[model samples]
Target: MSNYVIQADQQLLDALRAHYEGALSDRLPAGALFAVKRPDVVITAYRSGKVLFQGKAAEQEAAKWISGASASNETADHQPSALAAHQLGSLSAIGSDEVGTGDYFGPIVVAAAYVDRPHIAKIAALGVKDSKQLNDEAIKRIAPAIMETVPHAVTVLDNPQYNRWQRSGMPQTKMKALLHNRTLVKLVDAIAPAEPEAIIIDEFLKRDSYFRYLSDEDRIIRERVHCLPKAESVHVSVAAASIIARYVFLEEMEQLSRAVGLLLPKGAGAIVDEAAARIIRARGEEMLETCAKLHFANTKKALAIAKRRK
Candidate 1:
């Protein structure tokens, strides 16, 4: 097992606690705030603002929080490709991205949008950029314009089906790859006889791993494919796709909130856990299967909170 240690402020520690809420272990060491045991790594946080990471993937997980560590170990696939910077954005291309993977209360949404060369400047004029930079209201405002202006396809994997897939041992990465691929295929077919110059996917995995994940799929769209990190910056199509995916995810979350008679927040934060406990108290545990991703660590955390509240 590998070992890594870092000192973090209380704010960072609290953020870590929220991020790892689902992975919380009951067996806390004396003076330790929490311990988390994942398949590849074990993490422990202490009151002194120190965090320890162990196990095979310790460095990989730790790299996320330590800026230089990620830069030093960055893989080629994570870098924006030359072709993407020089040509892909200005050419007719299909750009794909996903949203809601990190949220505990919404469906995973994937979208692919086709933006032709001439329309690039027009799309940019709408302030299309990374979805992370825009609020829900902005996403709502811009997504419909993008839809009206471009040909796109979206896939939404709701919580029940997502839970079922997780229970059956489907990794989230594979699920995303499948969704991106399926949506790309749909968009390609929808715009038949008009072949795109390229297909760019906001890189989640290495290019080889992405193809490996889709190796079992019957229909794989591989021609002119480029996987680049921060793909939205590389092309306007990706930005549009990100906005549309977020818009759809927001719509789904609103509908689910209405169905559950409670406003479901985004992200896996303390608020999410509290909201989940409320649902369990008011609606029962089974209601979560219909509305929340059951496999998230939030499920157990919420159950514990609900039980304690009783």
Candidate 2:
């Protein structure tokens, strides 16, 4: 699919909005500019003059609004392998990515998926993009399809375990590398493909810093490791990993919410803090440890709120 991000004036944005007014559907809720959904494309327009166009006809659609076409298109490129993975002469690759590390209420989930050449078309047709752009329902729908066909492994660090790991003084980067490497290796071992071409990691750190995190660990597959940012846009495997990770994270959040009998919102925002405070008021601080990452600063605010209620 052809996609582009363009900076346009309000006039241009208004023009497009009016063009798609009736066909313009509400999708993602941004502050000012709404996501106007058309039959073939999804547009995220911001009042700040940033507009993103994504879908098969993204370029054509955006051309109707913008004067100059932005040449930056991620369609032809696959994640972690844009050039390096292709150099390997085959699309048989494993890509690793994670989700929910920044969330206040869910587990940190990492997933690795092996995308064989034969399944490339299949994966593309699944409309696998970065997990951030996808809604919970879309992710939940696509994840199982990827899981059923693609060889994959997912590792989840629940809140309690995440807190314990943090107390052990391991940085999140190191922990991510640990899980990503292990999951990729496990997926590779499970499939045991005939010399899979490349193994890519969604680069969380700089090229050197990422390796530095893995320097102490011998588990990393240094070979064919393409550490790329926003790899999900390019590599189906990374996108698949992102989706599956999100699905699992959402599932964990659902279970945690059920256990607490409250809706646990994502992110470390003020709203999340309010929810945390409510949880603590009902259950003791001990129960918060089970449902949330205790190391976050939100814990302190929730404790204060709990004390205030007392």
Per-model TM-score, in order, reads 0.74, 0.70
Deviation (Å) of 142 in candidate 2: 1.1
lDDT of 1 by residue, 218-281 (tens): 9999887877778898789999999999999999999999999999999999999999999999
Error in Å for residue 82 of model 1: 5.7
Error of 1 at 288 (Å): 0.7
Best by lDDT: 1
- Report clash pairs, candidate 1: 22-297
Write model 2 residue lDDT over 1-310, tens digit each, in one string. Answer: 5566677777777877787787666566656477777778888877777777788556445544545433244544322212422333246778889988888888889999888889977987999888899999999899999899988898988888888989999898888878887787788779864656777678786444676677777676666576766677556888888888999889999999999989999999999988999988888778888888888899999888778878
User: For model 1, what is the error of residue 120's alpha carbon versus the real structure, in angstroms, after optimal superposition?
Assistant: 0.4
Runs with alpha carbons beyond 4 Å of true place in candidate 1? 1-84
State in Å the error of residue 274, model 2: 1.2
- Give the Cα lDDT of each candidate: 0.86, 0.77
